[model samples]
Each structure stands twice: as structure tokens, then as C-alpha cells.
Target: MKITTNMHEGRRTEMYACGAWNDMIITDYLEMAVTKTPQKTALVGYRVHAGDRSAMSYSELDRRITRMAAGLAALGVEKGDVVSCQLPNWWQMSALFLACVRIGAVCNPLMPIFREHEMQYMLAHAQSKVVVVPKIFRHFDHQAMLQGLRSELPDLKHVLVIDSDDEQSFEQVLLQRAWEEEVDTARLFAERRPSADEVVQLLYTSGTTGKPKGVMHTSNTLLSNIRPFSERQGLSATDIILMPSPLAHQLGFLYGLMLPVYLGATAILQDVWEPAFAARVVAEEGCTLTLGSTPFLADLVDIARDEREQQASLKTFISAGAPIPGALVEKAASVMQGTKVISAWGMTENGAVTTTRPEDPQTTAVHSDGVALPYMQVKIVDGEGHEQPAGEEGDLLVRGASQCVGYFRQPDMYQLDNEGWFATGDIARKDATGYIRITGRSKDVVIRGGENLPIADIENTLYKHPAIQAVALVGAPDERLGERLCAYVTLHDSSATLTLKDVTDYLVEQKFTRQYLPEYLEVLAALPRTPSGKIQKFKLRDMARDIFQGQASHA
Candidate 1:
């Protein structure tokens, strides 16, 4: 099946004949760009600490990748070998990933913020042999964390450090061997190239519950999700993509690294998310597009509103992770001038399955995740696997080229039912126009007074408040209401002391139903978030359980 045309005239083209999944992987696109636009700027890294910037043209990046692949080969890395990376959005991370692909090694990218415990679990689960990381990031001493985990992780054979002042720096490896000295292992592993069905990465979901689950993806699965967005957004070599999302996260990997390079576009990478810094990068670098979480967008909007010329070159803002409030969407569109604010929905298991297209109507663009990408199928189904009628909300099940192969080492979680659909764990509804609106996570729905309450609705509503920095609503056990809404709020400014009355009064003003209003409010200095900036609601649930237990003891 092929995407025909946009509503506009003369915008049609036959889809590339590559298999649905094969087109999305970086290897195919990397080879294409190296041949076609070797001189184009493939990646640009902006350093915050030194105020120094660096860039690599496609030809240069390809050469460095070849050498790096050779370096890995020297270290005994082979096809299916897991090479874990804990670097930020630097050029080395991108180069290392391509090197892994060139040699058919599975790239296991971890957030730089991960400490000993998280690193141990990821390395052990993936059985990663080579771990590449930074010596220090922010205040976290990654070297110490690596040292602590190195003993227990028997499979870890090498530790490659980037941006380090220490002896094990990545630069040392390249300097020790010239490009001519290293063999091009890309050809040596040509026959072993990961097929469209083979796993390329073992991405761990933010362990909000139990231990983190490793979501496995093949080259085909990764590309299938990317191709649709590239086609939908009309991504091109002329566009400069700036991604504030962590490269470790699925969105960042697809949009920041793969999608931009897939289209031969320049990709601008930043190590961290700072609204002011992002604004400067977008404006100075002439970034045409960017994607980030709702909070990132909110912060950018606030920054743009305060500064007159912020994000002047940005043409598109892709918001995901959490609900994009209408106000933030409007603010982004207005500030960016001709920019479209697109709401996208997906998870670690599936790269963005649905997103608002460039030509979508404003209402649809603002409120919905838009239509499913080509080669992807989505359905709203009841608990028993029966499809629900249009305009009804149910568990969202998705199947497509981009769907993950399965969880690593967990075959039980990998098997699909006889029907072949993967349960997405999200509750969503499709309108008559085919736009999908995510209602809430299956676990996020609060059953209050025998009625289901959508947490997303309440959270989006709370986002409008001037003092509320972040809000998450979780269900707490209640004797009367079955389950009651317990709001965990983080204030924008600590000086602005708030109370339960302050929250209830604001909800009343917003016209939230009394039943939907939070029965208890816990004011926190900050919300616990994963490395990807997703709110750790499971932690809040634990806190709520403790609050209830303490109250019960007193009673």
C-alpha cells in the first residue's frame, strides 16, 4: 500500500518500493545519504559548557563510523552483540550507533542520567559487552556508577568514555588508529547484516513498575514508523531538525537521529533541555522543526512569549509524551509564525504510530494524534478483543511494521494472541474522521463513585493554572468512592505556597465535577520523572499508599 497524495495538488509520489519495515532503518538511509549527499551537514553538536560547536558532513560521519566499526571489531564486537551507550546528544553517540549498525551489533542506548542501579539492570538484561558512556554529566559521576556495575556484569568487556577528561576517552581509540589502519568491517559483516526481522536495539521502558522491560526493535520496525512521518511532514534535506528529546528515548532516536538523516537533512543535537538554550539553537541554526514533551513545549512557549525573537526559524513543533494543552499549542503556533503544533502518540514499544500531519486542519492538529501512519493499523477494542464502534473509547491495540519484535529475553511477553495485535496499554477513541484521541492510560483511569474518570482530562485542565508546574492524578484506595483521585502537584515557584483549598478552589473555577476533583492534594517540590521527562506516576502512587496507611494508623 502507498500513500497517494496530500489534499494539495501535484504533491503525490509513488512510495519507495522497500518493504514496509526495511525503509525505516538507519543503514539503508545512511548508505543512501553517503552516496547522494556526502557533503551535506549530517549532524551538528552544540556544547553548553565550553560554548564550542562541532559538525560532521555525511562523508566525514560515514568515514568515522567505518573506523569506529573497525574499532569495535578489534574489541571482538560482532553481529547481535549488545553495545550499551550512555552518552548525551553528542556526535559520538550518533557515530557509535551507526558503527553498531554497520557491524550488525545491537545498539543499546541508555539515558546519561541513569545511575548504578538502572545501568546494572539494563546491561545485565541486554548482556551488553561494550558500554560507552560519559565520565560525568551534570552532577552524576557516571564513572563511579560504571565501576560499581562492572563487577556484577560479566558480559561487559569494555568501557568507552566520551567527553571525558579520563584515560578511557573515545578520542583515544580513534587517535591510536588512523582511518587507513582500520579495516572496513561493513563489508565483512555484509552477509550478517541484520535482516528486517532481526533485533537492532534493546530499549528499556522507564521502570515505573517492577524492573524495566527491554523493548526489542528490528531495522524494519524502526524504519516503518519513521517513513510515514517523513512522508507526512515532507521532511527534506533543506529542513534542519532540532530535537530536545533525549536520544535515549524512542522519539529522539527516530526524529533526532534517524528521521533527519533518513531524509538527508541536518540534525542539530543538544545535550540537555534548557528553554533558553534551545531557543538560541533553533534561531541561530535555522532549525525548521523540533519535537519534545509537553513540558518542554510549555517552557519554550513561556520563553518565546517573554523574549521577542525566540525560535524565529522554527517552522514546526512536535509535542508528545503528555497531552498538549490547547493553550500551549496556540502559543507555539503563534510564536513560531506559520509553524504547526503537532500532537503525536506512541511509546517505547512502538515508535510514534500516529501523528498530526502537516496539512491537518487546525482543530484536528491541536486536539488529536491524527491518523495512523501508512503500513500501521490501529483499533479500539474491548477487553475480550472485540473491536469497538467508531467514536467509542477502549484499549488501543496497534500492529504495524514499526511494532517491536518483542521484549528482550522475555519470550512470554513477546507472543501475540492468535489475532496478531499488540495491546498498547493506552485507552483511545477514533472519531468519524479517523483522528485518534488518547483518553488515558489503562491504569490511569480512576474509578470514582462507580464512574471512570480520565486522568488526562484533569491533568490537561490543571496545566492551565499559572502556579502549577506539573500535575499527575493517580487513584488511591478509598472506602466510599471505590477509588479516589489523589493529585500530586509540583509548583512552578516554591515561594508561592499552595494548599488543598487552593487546588479545590481552582478546580471549582475550572468547572471540574466534584466527583472528578482530587480528594487529596500532595504538594511536592518536584515530580519524580524518568530520564525521558515522563512523570513517574508509580512513585506518586506509592506515596499516596503511604499517606493512606499513615492516616489509617492514626485513626
Candidate 2:
């Protein structure tokens, strides 16, 4: 495929590459997988009693990807076009992603849970040409929602509906025979493939602003992370991958789909977050490698405890998005049997930066977030952007191949310091051995159960409510989710009071997703502040924790 760099239609490869992505692209890996292991179990999914329902071989997946690419071309999706997909971990998504790279279109995967509040900003900003959504996922009517959003997104020409009753059916259109008789599928596939350095993925991450930031990543940058991370854990084609995390999230996006293709392994998809189902999939599919948040590991441990013998063939479990405690690691080995629990740390811009290797001591995996991958560099920095000494608790910055070139539409937002370091906005410390430990986040966002809540956006939206005089959204400590959002609000009048129901209703009207709505509401007479008139968020966090846990609010 011809190279398309950054947020535009045409740019030189040198503009973004720095010096990578010359030899191959993402689809090349799938091509290699098919060539090397034509009959190998390439993809697997679902843990329904019916068995591992979604399973596909290497050649079978390749054929589907080819057809889907041609089908997308028939639907007016050209090179450099953005195809936005908001889907669950269905078997079709894998083919769709491969199809995008094959047809030279950018793959934009949005969270299935993203409501109009999140979708509107990203879709419009990206100027996506074609959008694919499930008819109904988890009781949400995405088909109707995208249809309603059409007027707002003028560039959105096609809205493909998955498993639906319509002329524009997702499966019927993308996976069926070539739709356009004039176009030859073979020639189209050969000519439309993208360069390895082209911006193949246009993903969105939560930002300080109400809107989401679109992060652009190339095939090389993404593979740089996956190739090393998987190799470090000794992943192979024989391994079965159980992907419990949502494919929309970066963790699942890299390891869930791309990593499997890279390994030529079978990937089992669990659409929903059900621990029992996840465990069942692992056992049935003989899943060996999986990566997700700490909560996932915790839930799986609980699920394993009920079993007399370990049925699952789990080898490595890399828990990320939060810290993994020592207690959980010891318990996992006993209950999960053969599974080795590891920890990882990274974000949307960089896929998997640091990960505890299979060789590291179990204790190191439990405490530290692990050493940086070969494709990247990690260092702690002070407020003035100077590199901090080892063991100094300061801001964490990472630079290297796995990092995204820039943010889509908002290139200015992708700022880097003089040394090419990108501030992670996370306060962390690197040990003398190069292992990093995350202390806290400087960004104003609440990462609940691995889903990032737009703290500033929610607070700003709530402030518009007439009854809310002052509002601060802070993450209160929680065992399961790591942290839960709590809204500390002061009413306009003494008689006016805000309840959880009141805040939920107000946020709902603002088009915020239910997941982002605060679970607890702390009504305060006045918000505590520093001497200089800045809001003391630390004080509010304490109050939120106190109120949420049924303790008395000191304020």
C-alpha cells in the first residue's frame, strides 16, 4: 500500500517513520501466518455451553479477509479512508480489521460502550467515511444511534449493521462475494494494501477535555510492541489466546487481535466481562496466553478456586491497567495451577511498553510494572522535564518505536519534549534494575475497572446543572475496580440536595455513558481549597473515600 502519514491523505514515509516500517505491514503478518500454518487454528471465540463457537483456521481467515477487503472497496471505501467500527469481541471484527489494512483504509475501533457523548466527538473529528456497528450490543441499539448520528457526520457515507435485517448488512456486505462486478478482487487486494508505516489505526483515548483524543498508529509501531512482548513471554503458534478484555481497548486491540495474527495462534474472544465464561473459554480452548487488567486476574482466580483440577492450559497471564499485588500472585499460582501471572504497563499511544517477563521472579512481577520492552525506553522525569534519578518518584516519560507518530486531527496535542520524551502523565519511579513502579496519575481521569472515565468532562458537564454550585469528580478507592468515581457537589441553595439518581439523570441527558456516571455522591457545604484558591483534590478524594465506605465525612 502507498504510505499515508499523520492525519492527512498524503505524506512522505520519513515524516513519521524516524526509521521503521520499510519491509512489511500488518496484513503481511497475516499473509505469513497463512503461508506458514495454512491449517493452524488462527482464531477462536465464545465460551457458550455450545462450546468454543467462534473458531477459524489460518487459510479460512485469510480468505475472509480478502473477500472483506474487496467488499469494502465495492462500498466506496477507498485508500486513506477511515472505517470506524464499534463492535464487541465478535469473530467478524478480526476479519474487519485485517480487511482495513488490506484495502488501505485506516481501522478505527471505538468502544461498544461509547455513547453519543463519546462517539460524536471522535466520528466527526476523524471524518470517517464508513462506520460499522452492531444492531444491538448489550441492549444498546447502535444501529439506530449511528443512523441518528449521520446528519452530524457528513463524511460518514456508509453505516454497516452487524447481524441485522437490512440491505446494508455487515456480514452480508463485507464477508460475502465481491459486490462490485467491475472490480477484480485479486487486483484490488494487491494494489490497495498499505505501507507498513502508514497510519493503519486511528484510535481514541480519554482526554482532559470533554472530547476524546484520536491517536494515530502505524503497523510497524504497533507490531514493535506485540512482537517483543509476546516473544518475551515465549508465545508461539501452538498457544491459544483467551482475550477477555474488550477489543476496543488498547490492551485487547494489540494483544487480542494483532498479537494473535503475529503469533499465528488461535485467539478466543469473550465479548462480555463474565469470569466464569472467561474461565470456561480458557478450559475449552486450551488458552495459554492472555493479558488484561488486575480485576480480570482476580476474577479468574476466584473462578479457578471452584475447580478440583485445572482444565485450562493457561501459561501466562499479564495483568495491566493497574498494579498487581503480591497476595494475588501467590494465590493465582495455587488456584490457577500452571498459569504464570505477570504485570504490564502502557497506553493508547504506545501499545505495551513494559511487561514482567516469564523469567522474572514471581515477586518482581507482583510488585514492579516490569522493565521496558526492547522497542521502547522508559524514564522518570521531574516537573521541569529533567530526567530524575533512579528510584525518584516523578513523572514517567517513554520514547521509541512503539509510540504513535501523532494524534489524528489534533496534531498539536501530540507534544514531545526536547529529548523526544512523551509524558505519560503518570507519576512513577524506575528502580536501579530498570523496573518501573506507578505511584499515581497526574491526569484528571478515573480509570475504573480498566475503563477510563472522563473526570474533567464529567465535572464540566455537571457544573452546567443549575442545582450544582460546585462539583469535583475524583476517584475513590475500590477493591474491584481499583478506583470508583465519586462526585462531590455543593448545591446552589441549602435546601437543594443532589442524590445519585439526580446526577445520573442529569448525566444521561448530557449523553454520558452509564459507566462514567459517579457511583457515589458526596454533598458538601463547601469544597476545601488551598491557600492560593486552588481546589484541593487530595482532600476531596479523602472525603469521597470516607463517604463511599460509610465513614463520616470530616468536612
TM-score per prediction, in order, is: 0.77, 0.94
User: With candidate 1 superimposed using the best TM-score fit, by how many Å does residue 409's alpha carbon deviate from the native?
Assistant: 0.3
**What is the model-wide C-alpha lDDT for candidate 2?**
0.82
What is candidate 1's lDDT per residue for 449-486, written digit by digit as tens? 33446467568778888899999988775543345679
**Scored by CA lDDT, what does every candidate get?**
0.76, 0.82
Clashes of each: 2, 1
> To one decimal, what is the Cα RMSD in angstroms of model 2 from the true structure?
3.2
Residues 1-555 of candidate 2: C-alpha lDDT, one tens digit per residue: 233334332222432454433456778888898999899888876734335476788999888787777788887888988899998888778788999888889999999888998898889988888888988877889998888888999988899998787887887766566553556866787888776767888889876655678888888788777777877888888888888898888998988988888887888888887887777667767788888887888888888889725545888898888887677888887887777888889999998799887888788877799899885899898888788888899999998778887887676778877656789889999988899999998887788887777787888899999899989889887666778888888898978767899999999998888988888887888899889977889988887777667743432
lDDT of 1: 0.76
* Model 1 segments more than 4 A misplaced: 1-19, 23-25, 165-167, 179-186, 189-192, 306-309, 444-555
